[model samples]
Target: MAECTEESTMCDPRHALLLQSVQSGLPLVHRPYAELGQRIGMSETEVIGLLSEWVAAGIIKRIGVVVRHRSLGYDANAMVVWDVPDGRIGDVGRRMSAFDFVTLCYRRPRQGDAWPYNLFCMIHGKDRANVLAQIELLAASCDLTDVPRDVLFSRRCFKQRGARYAARALAAS
Candidate 1:
């Protein structure tokens, strides 16, 4: 068995082949992994096993759709950042995420006196008015109105893609 650390998780020819083939895309068929396996000369089970191992080894975070909200008719996307008391971040963040309008929520490091916001949430709606309304409602509902916060509505999307890591494997003859 080729354990993930056995040149399979990273810097392995086999792994590179798999990554390059799928970098463009996975097959659109029902059994995409199976299709990939067939193209890469591996059994479906083998493909699945390799993927599982890679994920466990942190070589892969996740494979899912990268939905373009604006293309999907959602014109309003606002990133709400909050500066809650240090002790309340976890509780406040979890509460903020409970709102149906809050699509994405996470925490980030705060820059002392400069930019104090640590918790962030993204709210998507049909339009700017709708998004602002949701944010107002969130403030009241989540009891964050008292908390220092700012809403940065997206002006335009510059880029959205998967992570690009520099090559670590030199081609082998």
Candidate 2:
């Protein structure tokens, strides 16, 4: 197998082909791995085995699907950040996450004065009014009505995709 290093711009040819095949997005088939393998002259087992090896070796970090929420009519997207007391953050975050409207939630360190908020959650809805209403509901239900928070609505959609290892490797080749 070929080796890739920080100084080396390329990787194994087979791995390069496999990465290229998946970079665009996996096929919408019952057996996507098998389809990927067939496209690159590899067997389903070979594809799965290679992916496993790379993962164990720390060559691949993660594999996940990127959903296009706007295409699904979820036009209003807001990231609601809050400044909860350190002692209450865990409880508040948990309660906030329990809501079906909150698709994502996590915590971050409060930036001194530049940014005071810590806990954060994402809410997506069909319209801005609905999203704002949901935020109000979240604040009331989570006992966060007194918390200092901000609801930032996205004004633009960014291209969502996975890593581009194949592009770099191909450029080097």
Local distance difference test values of all predictions, in order: 0.77, 0.86
Measured by TM-score, the strongest candidate is 1
TM-score of model number 2 = 0.68
Each candidate structure's count of clashing pairs: 0, 0
Model 2 C-alpha lDDT per residue in residues 48-150, reported as the tens digit of each score: 9988887897776676767788899998999999999999999989999899999999999999988999999999889999899999999999888999999
C-alpha RMSD values across all candidates: 4.6, 5.0
Residue 58 in candidate 1, Cα distance off native in Å: 9.8
* Highest-scoring model, lDDT: 2
Candidate 1 residue-wise lDDT, 49-143, digit = tens: 88788789787777677677889988788898988788888887888888888898998999998999998999888889888888888788767
Candidate 1 TM-score to native: 0.73
Backbone clashes, candidate 1? 0
